[model samples]
Target: MCASPVKKNEPDNRKGQAGGDSGPASRSRTDRRNSQAAKPKREHVKKSARDAALSVLTGVEEAGSYSNLKLNQILREADLPRPDAALATEIVYGTIQRRNTIDYYLAKLVTKGLGKLQPWVRSLLRMSLYQLLYLERVPDHAVVSEAVNIAKRRGHQGISGMVNGVLRSAIRQRAELTLPQGMTDAERISLEHSHPEWLVRRWIKQYGAEACERICKANNEPPHVSIRANARRQHQDALLEQLRLGGFDAEPSALSPAGIVVSSGGNMALTPGFGQGDYSIQDESSMLVAEALQPEAGMTVLDCCAAPGGKTAHIAEKMDDTGTVWACDLHPHKKRLIDEQAQRLGLKSVRTLVKDARELAGEFEPASFDRILLDAPCSGFGVIRRKPDLKWGKREEDIAGIAAVQQSILEAVHGLLKPGGVLVYSTCTIERTENEDAVARFLEAHPEFVFDPIPTTGWPESAPLEQAASGMISIMPDRYGTDGFFIARIRRLA
Candidate 1:
């Protein structure tokens, strides 16, 4: 276990000697052990879960890899125990989720800019600090020890020493660490809330500073599991009993009768009755869309943009799987996703289509279906909790651009709706332009189309309705403990 402290200033020596000395780097064994003790002990020679996570996080920083997908790949390949894998997953995601704040603190502690540091060193520090602050299960000594050991394996001695010094400095200043004050609102939100500066400013303008902070904070909190019970298998009461028996603390959603919330369930696919299609993993707000549609037996319904069809299957289930449910998406591969879900739930009436929703006019005559569901593509601001990267990845211009496409899709589908047939327009976003504006514009051009009220049963009594020219529902994440969503129910005049 003898080693030398590699220094950057020293010339490279092929002889593998420390500072050009042919003799041992330390005078005695006691001194060698003590010197090592002064910093951190290298516990594992090969690798640990922390080591794998550090490597993957470094890849995320350097290669711009998606955190969830990359982490999953690592978890699948690594042979670490379940607990260790879980810890690594938490470290990687926590660091990625709080990248801005972690770097801000590092910059305050270090003399050099964090961006200029080697990507590996940056990743090491971020992971270490994330565990130190957020992971109560991991002790401080273990955090420091693993970080130093990782540095030894991946970096020279000087880099390892610097990592130790920087982490120690962060620990000492944990109480005094504060974001710089007296800055722009965007900067304040970014620093205080740990969101990207660009996103903070955009949110500040879109939703004031107070509301922006609320949304940013919501994004950091761990997401909840909201399941939609498959009525085909069991009723809500029976499913709740089944979930409790399966070791999940379950409860019915206050809003949706079909919705169930689980406090903890490691892997949902492995849960009881999942293979038999007892329930499906979906958010509470999404269940609202199918409820608002109110499809009945023998009614023909079209789910525009329905791929990976949760709403489509729910619609079929609501109709007792008796009526035809045409699920359409632009991509042919996505059609299989809907078909698979339909087969799992034993819904024989659900059919999949690969045609574009805009061209439905040509494939079907006007007023062809009894009901239509247009869950348009959107910027997805409302579901930030499940997709944290959206807060940093989305741009201001992107919102308006998506809204235009949503409007065009609405125009195309309006003619296909039968007189007295309801069209439910929805998006997993909070932007007014996509929800309120799209509905407003549609009402202005088509005087025959009128707003259909969402039934009181579909929503909780606590929520207040805002009267709009074209009636729409804007469900913000803050209002309901669900992803941000907007739903508007409209009907064509007979």
Candidate 2:
């Protein structure tokens, strides 16, 4: 049986108001005082892991905060032990990821219907059900007990009873729970994978049903932590050896020559040589963007939409910290992030600029940069593993709107590249409309830029170089074990 994280003998923290005294007129003043003192005193309940997770979930739903950001904030404030903190993070993210499916079960068990339930109550039920359905390590009774306790403290007795009854019913009926009989293929896949039906249908249209299912499943898994070794500071081999010697399960990534996959280390910044600028934490797929640009010494590069400057710093490292790499973003606040990354990596070539990519043509001279990277903003569907809330947060219509923005940015920045220069347009999204289709539209409009094949010399030999030869690469998370990403390299022809 799983041990309950709830503390023993916790206070209920509720007080009943004084009722009118009809027959107590004869009672003595001391007797009345003694009666008042006999009532149990209300004390604040000790916070539990479930309470922290519930608070984070409610914040995400009501305040529209990002799950990762909100979860980190709550965890730090709560100062929970390691095991409890892990549980809270799991419950928060897992419930958000499996919300639709949990609601499906909840609606069946909840007689008043899930729609009528208060937002917090619905959130509580979803989190509890997520544990009952997915977290096998937690016993069902303990989940029910903890949820009931929370419902009682947060709601009235009626609400607490409702939660208890619903959870107990769910536990008893777990064997009988099933998807509706006549659900269409899209509906079935959507419910089973906890994805929006429209998104699933869109993916099916683009990638077929089997591949779409694989993509959906992959999105629910935790993302691998990979870091790129700074070539200016240390060799990849040396970094890998150093990490292993420091008791980290590190190995070279199969995708990027400069990438290292760390399996055991919790925080890469705390690892050895991190402060010395040996490496920076980045996904292998993201590292590929800088590699695709193939930056060399004495080349001017523009990284449009560079914030948190991962790829921008990588571009500078690839250039041997020589020449110039202008990193630009819309938010002035994020300029420090890019500056900090450059400082950490000891790269003096990268310069930070505060400017939107769409407005770059007005600020910079035309044909000024030898290479450009447009890591455009999109719906972020590809990184669902890292940001599971995206699965529930995004709508089908968001794709077309974001695609238009991507196209506009591409057009605005195209004139900034010098003749015979390389421009790598990439997004952490697998949607074709924002990726291949966007590139297609750009090429049709601008005749001078032509597709440039992604060089595959140092890439894994198993990579489909031929398929990616047209200067376009779409990596699926399920197939590649990396974030779903799309990259297209276009070169200007004088």
Top candidate, metric lDDT? 2
Q: What is the C-alpha lDDT of each candidate?
A: 0.74, 0.80
The alpha-carbon RMSD values of the candidates against the true structure, listed in the order shown, are 11.2, 9.8
The regions of model 2 sitting more than 4 angstroms off are 1-46
Tens digits of per-residue lDDT for model 2, 163-206: 89999998888876667777777887788878999999999999
Q: Model 1: residues >4 Å from true position, as ranges?
A: 1-48, 55-64, 118-120, 155-158, 205-207, 458-470
Give lDDT tens digits, candidate 1, residues 226-291.
788888778888989987886788988865668888775665655657678888878888888887
Q: Extract clashing residue pairs from model 2.
A: none
Q: What's the lDDT for residue 2 in model 2?
A: 20
- The global Cα lDDT (0 to 1) of model 1 is 0.74
Q: Give per-residue lDDT, candidate 2, residue 42.
A: 35
